[model samples]
Target: MIERELVIVGGGPSGMAAAIAARENGVKDILLLERDQYLGGILNQCVHTGFGLEYFKEVLTGPEYADRFIKKIRGLPDIEISLRSFAVGMTGDKVVTFLKPGRMERVKARAIIMATGCREKTREMVHIAGTRPSGIFSAGFAQKLINIEGLLPGKEVVIVGSGDIGLIMARRFVLEGAKVSGVVEIQGQSRGLVRNIVQCIEDFDIPIYFNHKISRIYGRDRVEALDAVRVDENFNEISGTKFALKCDTILMSVGLIPENELIEMAGVAIDRKTNSPVSEELNKTSVPGIFVCGNSFKVYDIVDSVTRDSLAAGKLAAEYLGRARA
Candidate 1:
């Protein structure tokens, strides 16, 4: 077993920020573990520019914002980065077990930071009744397919939510020469930022159906169409309001849930509704010497906020280590 002063369980914006802050606060031994081959996490696939306004005082793309911190981490010799390391287990005593390419390793640290981030809600989570089809995808997964893999998901698309990602992807599909039939939302107003609603929807003249939902999806091999219905203020389907939309793809942008299962496995109390850690203070969890930052603690809408809170988690880990030594 390898031992370290700090072990950070993610290498995205949160993990990188925490590592930098901990190093600045005099925590020398630091390990940053990333599951992906690259360190940027979801930022790697986010190519649009709306990030780093508050943190860097400049607008940057997702990759660009992540690059700034990645460069800083490379320059700091005290921080160790392990890419493609999937953390599998965490003990109450801060022992993290992760699996790499061909080997599994364990690290026991004086302080541990979980920057595991969050996952998107799927059709099942939203109780959308549909035949399991090939063209259904989460908004984030579609973003990755288009941005990173350089492949379009489909030619005709229908987004099933008015969240930020769904709004942004509506523009992306149009830019890529695909037809966005419309966006369906059960709420009266969009859940996304106003700026996104303007830039991604109204600017492109994309149709958005407010107080509507995709009640049923129709397809056998791939997505053929969707059964949409108008909902009352209580989200109940109104009689004789069902309609059908023809589309080849369906994208779900319902919501995001914090990834806190590993922390819960380590005996940390978690809020069932939000799936976030129950913390007394910011970045401080119920368990001592184990801190959580970024979306693992709470889902933030912007990356800048994630960086801000993660920096604090790093400092807290450094202070915890100092007390452990004293």
Candidate 2:
């Protein structure tokens, strides 16, 4: 196996920031592996302007924010980037196995940083009883379909959960000439930021039903409607509050969970509640020389926070390498 001083298992904002930090801290032979064809990850699909306010002190779109880091990574020759490289396995001793286009490779690194990001909660995860239909999509997947693939998922939409992504999509669907019936949230208030709730829902005059839940989905071949009901403080459905939301599509934007399976494969202790590594300190995992940052460690509210946390992780990895060499 090839030997590396440091290996970062993602190429999004977190991985890029960590790699850059490690290289600047005097660690050489670093490798960054990204499963996607591009390095930006989900940012590539986010065409809206709201990022980089904290880090760059300027408002930028997701792609633009990611480009700033990507350029820095390109300038650093010490950090090698491997696009379309999926890390499949990792060992407790820092052995990482990944797959490329035509070959599989392994690297034994002195230190490893996981920046694997987070995954969206789907319809099944939320326990929305529904037929396996065509029109249901996660809010993030809808963003990709609309912004990346240039495909409209549906014409009439009922968004479940007023999470940031769902709120954003409510406006996006309206902008694309689709009718958004309303945003349904089981909680008493929206789960998204104040700005998102204002700009995406309130400003657009999109109705949001608080204390409401999607109890069931109605469809034959595609989404036709949804059974919406109000819930009490205990989340039990309220009687006489059942209603039908006639729509062709359902977008779920409940929440995000950290992607930590790779670290778990490495014998790292995980907190069952958060599904993240059990770290006593920021970015420091239970296993020595293994670090985690960004959404893989825990979902953050903004990209700027992810960058800051990842820079710290990179510094920690560099410090670990220094001790190993000593």
Candidate 2 local Cα displacement, residue 122, angstroms = 1.1
Q: How many residue pairs clash per model? A: 0, 0
lDDT string for model 1 (45-112, tens) is 88999999999999999999999999999999889999999999999988899999999999998889
Error of 2 at 61 (Å): 0.5
Runs of candidate 1 exceeding 4 Å displacement:
323-326
Judge candidate 2 at residue 321 and give its lDDT: 88
